[model samples]
Target chain A: MTEYAGPLPTPTIDTAPFWEHCRKHELRMQKCLDCGHVRYPASVICPKCYSENSEWASMSGKGTIYSWVVFHQAYGAFFAGIVPYAVAIVELAEGPRMLTNIIACPLDEIDIGMPVEVAFEDITAEFALPKFRPLGKP
Target chain B: MGSLGDKYAIVGVGHTKLGKVPGVSSIGFNVLAIKAALEDAGLTREDVDGVLVKYPTSGFSSLFSGKLCQALGITNKLMAVIDLAGATIGTMVQYAAMAIDAGLATTVVCSYGDNPLTGPPGTYGRVNSDDAAFGFVGAPAGYAMAARRHMKEYGTTSEQLGAIAVAFRKHASMNRNAQMQKPITLEDHQRSRWVVEPFHLLDCCLVSDGGAAVVVTSAERAKTLNKKPVYVMGWGQAHPAWDIAQRESLTVTGAKRSGEMAFKMAGVSPKDIDLAEIYDCFTYTALVTLEDYGFCKKGEGGSFVQNGRIELGGELPCNTAGGLLSESGMPGMLLLVEAVRQLRGECGPRQVNNAEIAIASSQGGILTTHATLILRR
Candidate 1:
């Protein structure tokens, strides 16, 4: 795992479970029990059906790059050394999209619609970030 | 359905010197802008009975419109603190007009101010998402991602985006209050440093320290004010989705619905608008908004902006006061101020000839929220 100095996210009551799953390298998300709808960032109610009944389901950890950008400038000291890194919106196979960093691939090679899979990077002792690497990478 | 159209008019507009005004707090800018707006209307603090402010609200700060009213030493019976981000100003005007129509207050003042440049950078309001943990830093990166998607879907070229900056810079050279007055060609835009991929340094707006305010009153009472009344012909506000990454289409913006509402209410079309004070936080933003607002078909904004179609005296002039690109970046209220000035025939050299009808579209939060207004003489 690469060392990270960026600010860590504080888990909320609704989102703590997702982070807990991430720490174990298991990708999980809330699925609406009433409508079989899936949601990201762990919401209590379904956006499509407004159903309060939900359950956590493990994801396949597969997604496609919907869009990406290369940050040439760093807004903080932690990113100074990582200038020109790629951040992308990856659309998971289950229908929800997430903002994540594309790793293990050259920044110039990242493009929309490229297949990718999640890789766990333990940035801290208590938390591990779910980053994406190009499919088939070792 | 009843409408607030033609019932209210912008009687006065005021702005402080934009770009790097030291020793001014955020609240101080509001007071300065309000006082100037009142003075421009030939009125006093007592004449203002309603107040609306944007920013430092909605988890940003404890300060609200009531506090701003207290700071200005005025007792307003009707006041609100709107937190729609860049759409704050555009939405504020709508609420002010509704307040007037509802007999809530006679005269309303809408204002906003921030010292993002002179004070701490990134102090301006931005969407706080979990994406921040993934190094999604600020508005530039979020907007850049959308621009990239647009390029992929529509084949939008960097040069087409550059044309927007060049047009705004050319207009800014004619205005004294513009931060960047020197003309920049497409080459100049291409040669500038990249802030993020697909966005050059010139493509971004100036981080400015300033404030702007406008007075809204009934058209019946505006005849007694000091300036010519710019009637609010039509206005609308919309939020497609708050989350930028989850929008159905990256290129489509809230202006799609908001602009439609405004035009339908005004009984006008895109061809009827003589000038467009559309938000230009970035060059691509203007292009996308132009398409979403029906200025052109979708994916044709790149071509619609080329060949000086948006320059002064073109088929449709945009950013007449250089907009946020060349003027101050105090959000979209400045666009309202410039639109009113153009309709009143006050803009000296950068004025669009016989600009009787104008449209100003303001967006906030990575194109999440939008407000459109059609103002006429």
Candidate 2:
């Protein structure tokens, strides 16, 4: 019930729908109509095909941990209490990467290539951050 | 030799007293560095026609380099700011040569200065909106992830990273002006506290208040100057241009292509060089960049740096002035400055023996951008 004191992404004209979809607990990426390259941090054109035509496509939000780090030190004030937290680069099943947090897991339990699925954290009334958790087993 | 190779040369190099220079401002550092460099080149402020600056880390302005010109009380035919983060220094030199080559300017001074040590609070921990929401705020988090991945992929131990810290600190002990003069061992590296997982305090570069500058001119003009000219043998730049998440492989960096471009232009290979002034933003960076430059095989950096091979008398003396690890962490400017000094035999204690050619590398944005400058005396 407390307000989110940490930083949040300010939606741009192009990135608006991505966040809008997140608020609805639906993870969507901008997919190129020409080459079908799904991209994050939504852009006007697809990096692979350079096509202006695109769609807000749905994602399974299931991914394997490509890489991760445990932050022993927090640089900002709000994060001071969380001395040790894990931020991971998730390789989505749909073929795009997301910079996100892996929640519902201990630090020692995380590893590269670990299967995970998306779980939403409603940090604020207006925004819901998409996090990940261990899928079933190690 | 590559086109435009050996065509330009660095005539002078100078730096402000590094390590906790508390009272001077960033701009003050730049001006002092320029004055010292000009004196080294036996030239006056009037001799400078172009000025390229890597804008101060602590401030921003529309005409930042122009502001530097105004501070020096001179008009420049060409002036601009370069912003490639740690790669700014090498980029500045390249831009200066191109400007001079096109007849836009004759003599150019490239410089960078920062006062983060004495700057206002929150300088080191400014809020980055992109990753801050995920309980990450500092610069180390991004690199920590990279270091961890390297560890997983190559079986690179924390001890392997410790070797890099040890070598650089040993070199620092010989450098009188280096920030961290006390030599530390691999055990000492292990004893240091962790700022981020997979990264010890010693694994990071020293933060300091300092400035460094170099004077660049045509090779012909450089020969006429007061001191020996460090010929600009070759230069090249490359950028991944993607965030860490989007990159195909986090373990690799652009240093591979950039180093090749420079070596081709300089008509040399990695083994042809005698010294390497690599940017050590993190211990991981030093290891990975050397690997990317073909100094050693991929995943072999940890072992390649194990012995005294990178030391002063070793196969390839690297970071002879301690680099960003023990030297002032002013991005990559000081690396090139040290390369210039080593080629000129200006370094008394830490100088490499009979140094002929050197490669100065600059890295920016979490291993995303890279620039390489090859120099020879």
Candidate 3:
């Protein structure tokens, strides 16, 4: 199999826990203490309530494909081998959306509102990306 | 707003040449545009009391801001660098006006400069984590997705999208400074290759290396300037959703919020707008913005452009200076300069006759951020 090697963002202090959970093969998002709102891309405070009291909670990793596109060109050399991959914005049941690549499925099968479940790919020592596949498929 | 309608004005504007000028440096182009703007305003460097630098794609810090001031030989002045992405240029005008309104500075210069084409390619890195994995790479791909969605949802045709390019090219042919003035036909646009599905090569904007600057000052101070003063009548901004996936609707935009706010502030409705300089990063951007701005109903942008509403002699003469699609894309700063020129009656062949009120709306960061400004003569 081809290896994935490219520059990855170093998780900062505020975002370290989220990356840690990703390493553990689980997707964790921040939930506001005051409003009970779930958010993504971990921030210092809740955007809704401005409350700093928040914690990382494990999500069910189930969502609908909100929108997607099939890329016919390679954006970079690292992904040049993976042309015609589907990138989708999944609206998680927890209320926040995440951008991720859909794998383990045919590109023609991808459709908006298709039910999906999280699948992890251990790409590197420090990172295990959270990709998605159809709910019942391998 | 204040009682000064048609009072506070843009007296001077300067723009660096477009396209790959690898011989020039980033800071060099910035300082050059600043000096040219100051000269255009008929003011010496010493007369500048405040500076607002909008560096969208650069590392703008207090040190850099101070370095620009020192290089321009302007000392003992208040300076700030505003980074608002695509709206950086239009927001500079609003920020300068606020400074004058609050009596913080008498004369202010807002400028942006860069050689996006000639610089080391791919230096900015991937904008998002998923972009690299799925090949949704740059702005073109991001926008191409939106265009596809718009067509899928509203029955918008590719030919209608090409009409925007056609209208802009017609206007660009009249502008000497426009980088891509060569005329193109609808067949030509369709024959062009595809960067993304449903969006051909002509639907994308050309990357150019250029800089543009504008001078904003108090109403009373502008009267004494040599050039015609294009008044800053109103301004507004809005952020619909930072992430495109989470937006309420993909076909619409947050420009409606900003455009409504600007119209209310200016006390003028859409019918009162004589001309417009909309941000056309892609043809769909302008089409969606037009609908969102209340110029046309939602899902009617394709038909609106087909009827020649955005052409030179049409009801609303839009992108008369040949938008970013046809003109040089100076990170959207030129939109403001072109709007000011149209209101001042300086656009020779593309000028809209009896143009009194003008509007310029800029969309930045994949429709994540937007800013609008109203100018009056």
Strongest candidate by lDDT = 1
Better of 2 and 3 by TM-score: 2
Question: What TM-score does each of the candidates earn?
Answer: 0.97, 0.97, 0.91
Query: Candidate 2 on B1-377: residue-level lDDT in tens?
Result: 23788999999888899988888877889999998889889988889999989877766668888778988887836888887878888889998998889899889999998888886654475775656777766667777788788889999989988988889989889988899889898889999988888898988998888989999999999989999999999888998868888887778898988998999889899988999999898999999999999999998998998888888899998998899999788898889988999998989988888999999999888888899999999
Task: Output per-candidate TM-scores for chain A, rounded to 2 decimals.
Answer: 0.95, 0.94, 0.92
Write out the backbone clash pairs for model 3.
none
Report the C-alpha displacement of residue B195, candidate 3, in angstroms. Answer: 2.4
Query: Candidate 1 residues B196-280, lDDT tens each?
Result: 8878888898878888999999999999889899999999899875576678888988999999999999989999999999999
- Expressed as tens digits, the lDDT of each residue in A22-134 for candidate 3 is 88998999998888989887899998899999889889999888767776655667666666677777889898887788888888888777899999877777777778898
Show the lowest summed lDDT stretch of 10 residues, model 2 chain A: A71-80
Listed per prediction, chain B TM-scores read 0.96, 0.97, 0.94
Give per-model CA RMSD.
1.8, 1.6, 2.7
Report the error of model 3 at residue B358, Å. Answer: 0.8
At residue B94, candidate 3 shows an lDDT of: 84
Of 2 and 3, the candidate ranking higher by DockQ: 2
Better of 1 and 2 by DockQ: 2
Ranking of all predicted structures according to DockQ, beginning with the best and ending with the worst: 2, 1, 3
Q: Which regions of candidate 1 are displaced past 4 Å? A: A1-3, B56-60, B120-129
Q: Could you tell me how far off, in angstroms, the CA of residue B212 lies in candidate 1 after the best superposition? A: 0.5
lDDT of 3 by residue, B130-213 (tens): 435334566776676677678767889999999999999889999898999998998999999766656788888777787788
Clashing pairs in 1: none
* Candidate 2 local distance difference test against the native: 0.87
The C-alpha lDDT values of all candidates are 0.88, 0.87, 0.80
